[model samples]
Target: MKWMPFSFICLLALGGCQAVPSSLPYADPPPSQACYFPSAASSTLTASVDVLTEWGFSLDASDTRLGLLSASRERELHGASDLYASPHFSSRTSLSVFGGMGIGGRSHLGVGLGGGFGQLPIEVERVSLLWDNHHVRVSRDIRRFDQYGSLRTGRSASTDDFCARFQRALDANTATGDSPS
Candidate 1:
């Protein structure tokens, strides 16, 4: 009978729980086309790198001979309310003293401290990129966990900003290398 309240509370907590939201539906990549600089693979790779760097991504992997490249960017989300519990803000203090002299004296004291609310610190965004023969594929993944520890994944739309810059860079490279015959 004494444990009935505890059991009921546990049941209620479980009943209120739900799974984290699922990721967005996958979308097929656009049709592949010949690169702007068909004969200049080096220039194409350089342009891809430049565009990726301009967009705040760093090179993670690359294979010049194979014409493969990968890049990623990471950032933390800020400005969220602190309405959860955290051990970082919870603390305890204790002091004890005992002495014997002309008269016996003894004293003991203890103290505990904790904050009412804490920040979850669980919002982050990551972007990954892959460069193939004549195309660059980009994927943005967002990860966040709630106070209840439920993790969620989100999808970000394709970024045409980099693509536009890449095309321009390729055009410039090809135009400059060709001289009057």
Candidate 2:
């Protein structure tokens, strides 16, 4: 009856409603800094790059004199729908007969076709390194999108593995006479 159109509109509005922000207070923790290597800045930077590459990250930036380095990697985490794409032709046919004697016949035809694969979710990672005369400092940040395609909070990634591997790499470099006495 007359209420049918109103009900359909309400259903669509409710179904597409956006999620509310949580009332619970939350904050991203500060990036962790650690002096895990006891090698000269240059040597530490080299070792850091090696560790990063070994862990599947490519070198994004580096400064030998400043003892700074950055690396990043990507991984697919989820699937997302592609917003662009078109499907093959689709045909719909409909015929209707009016109940009243005033109207003879009415017809409506609707055809819809859509096709596309959702884009896969990708996690982006970035790692930064800094070193001084006696120690090396490292920090990491990871970025990812939520199901709604909204950029979620970015937080520091684990430095434990990097620290361990960097230590070994620095030790090797020093053994080859790369470290300062």
Candidate 3:
């Protein structure tokens, strides 16, 4: 009859277990920005490249005929000090030293160290510009990578600030007949 308690406890534990919900919805994508200019697509593309370069993005691909441009920028997101302050490093170290004296004495000393040259967080921002005739649309995608080079998080959006800056720059360049520098 003593075993009945153990069986009931096991059953209770099993009943408490729940399957992870797999139907969780993902977040919505960020909004894109579009602007219209009276200038031709080719000129707009050239000016866009110049402005993007000023923003620290390197042109990855461009097709003037198709009015498409792609650029990306990468930057480090964290340093060694940030890594050391993270829980991934702080909570993993363990040290144990035990000594006992008796007929059956046992002495044990152990050191468990965790953490390595990992934990480099990087942020990559990619921008896509598409233009046709006098209308230009710009979208940005941002992704954060963990130390292992795996994507930690990502979002796609074109903020108003970016669109405003791009429009202002393009207007100035196109109006002044200033070629991309």
Candidate 4:
């Protein structure tokens, strides 16, 4: 029959519309680093606070008894100047008006207005340290926020390089006999 060829073509087209998988491969967590110290937990925590402060992070909270220390640092990814330079920073205005007569001779009018403003992004990095008498574990987290202070994205378990650097700093601090008050 003449319709057989057309049916075959339609089947071929439908078969070509297979759905492609959009799933992404799983990502492994970043490596963690631990530093060992010979000093008391309190002393190690104090030195950690000092090092973190030097790195621009302010101590948020700590409990030497529990060997827990938390610090955070915030920096603006876009400054005021950058915000001013953005295209969205310029003042804009939009208006639309429409008038129509219906079948019953009724008149209708509609108007729409819209505007937007630009906002900068801020980055905040946080670090946490836990330690015993001679062992310390450090972890870092990073988050991004909009100018309105709403978090956009965040990640935990930063790379090992940061912990390594902290370890070196702690080593130098202890080696120099910097007593913790």
Indicate which candidate wins on lDDT: 3
What are the models' TM-scores? 0.42, 0.52, 0.61, 0.60
Relative to the true structure, how large is the alpha-carbon lDDT of every model?
0.53, 0.62, 0.71, 0.69
List where candidate 2 sits over 4 angstroms from the true fold.
Answer: 1-27, 32-37, 79-117, 146-150, 158-162, 172-181
Error of 4 at 147 (Å): 2.3
The root-mean-square deviation over C-alpha atoms between each candidate and the true structure, in angstroms, is 11.5, 11.9, 7.8, 9.4
What 10-residue stretch in candidate 1 is worst by lDDT? Answer: 30-39
Minimal lDDT window, size 10, model 2: 83-92
User: Rank order by TM-score, top first?
Assistant: 3, 4, 2, 1
Q: How close is candidate 1 to the true structure, as a TM-score?
A: 0.42
Q: How many residue pairs clash in each candidate?
A: 0, 4, 0, 0
Write the residue-wise lDDT of candidate 4 on 67-105 in tens digits.
Answer: 899999988775533343324333223233334544556
lDDT of 2 by residue, 65-103 (tens): 887888999886643322211223111122323232343
> Which is the winner by TM-score between candidate 3 and candidate 4?
3
> Candidate 3, 180: how far from true, in Å?
13
